[model samples]
Target: MTIHRIVCAANRKRFTGQIVLGIRHWDLFMSEALDSEGDPVDQGFVDNRGNFLLRIEAWKVAEAAGQIIRRVGGDDTNGGTLYSENLY
Candidate 1:
């Protein structure tokens, strides 16, 4: 279960600020979640019109995603403002 965490940031001035965090299985699901050229899905977070911040691995995808969400804006009290999605 090679899990990979991806962090994405979207900043469009102060009107709209968004951070997207997600997880996917590298070995089992990455290929399916990505396109033929080894890129994330067309609708995947990374492909969205935003800044791709980071990608990491963890034992638990959810936990790792949460951590990435927390470190996004120097605080973790934004509740569910950080959107999340699973590629698989």
Candidate 2:
């Protein structure tokens, strides 16, 4: 379990709160419950199954995607950007 300090969108207050980690749905509902991580919260945000909502690390998510993209010939590095302009 990890504690994350965050602000609430409903009331806009800052507070420290406990976050439940090691849950399966942590990745799925993270964005949804992230707004309630601050002070003035009456209860911990959770789903019907008691899974806490938290944010996923961006780098970790990117790293996982990179592995999959590489396997499918989706490497963006190999592709070059082209800037087009109309010459009048």
Candidate 3:
């Protein structure tokens, strides 16, 4: 989380907020919610109820962080050039 914060601070034009997903949670989700081909099941995102619930929680946290950023005048409307640097 701290690393993400620093990176986002350095590249504010791209990132807004970060959500830390644990490896165990991700593994559990992949083991249960995905098909053998690594694709989502017929139910898609909600194939695993636990993972879906955690995803919703993370989304809400990020949304709240975005609202706080907007209130503090840190929105994405700064009109700065985001891709001015050349890609290697």
Work out the TM-score per prediction: 0.20, 0.18, 0.19
Q: Across residues 1-88, which tens digit of lDDT does each residue of candidate 1 receive?
A: 5444534322121222323233532333443333344323222234232344332222133345444433343123333223333322
lDDT of 2 at 43: 26
Candidate 1: pairs in clash: none
Candidate 3: tens digits of C-alpha lDDT, residues 1-88? 3211101101001132222222333355434433344333221111112232222232243344332232222224332111101100
Evaluate all candidate structures by whole-model CA lDDT and list the values in order.
0.32, 0.29, 0.25
| Model 1 bad stretches (over 4 Å) | 1-22, 25-29, 38-50, 55-88
Number of clashes in every candidate structure? Answer: 0, 1, 0
In candidate 1, position 81 carries an lDDT of 26
Better of 1 and 2 by TM-score: 1
Ranking by TM-score: 1, 3, 2
Error of 2 at 27 (Å): 10
Candidate 2 achieves a global lDDT of: 0.29
For model 3, the stretches where C-alpha displacement exceeds 4 angstroms are 1-53, 67-88
Candidate order by lDDT, decreasing, is 1, 2, 3
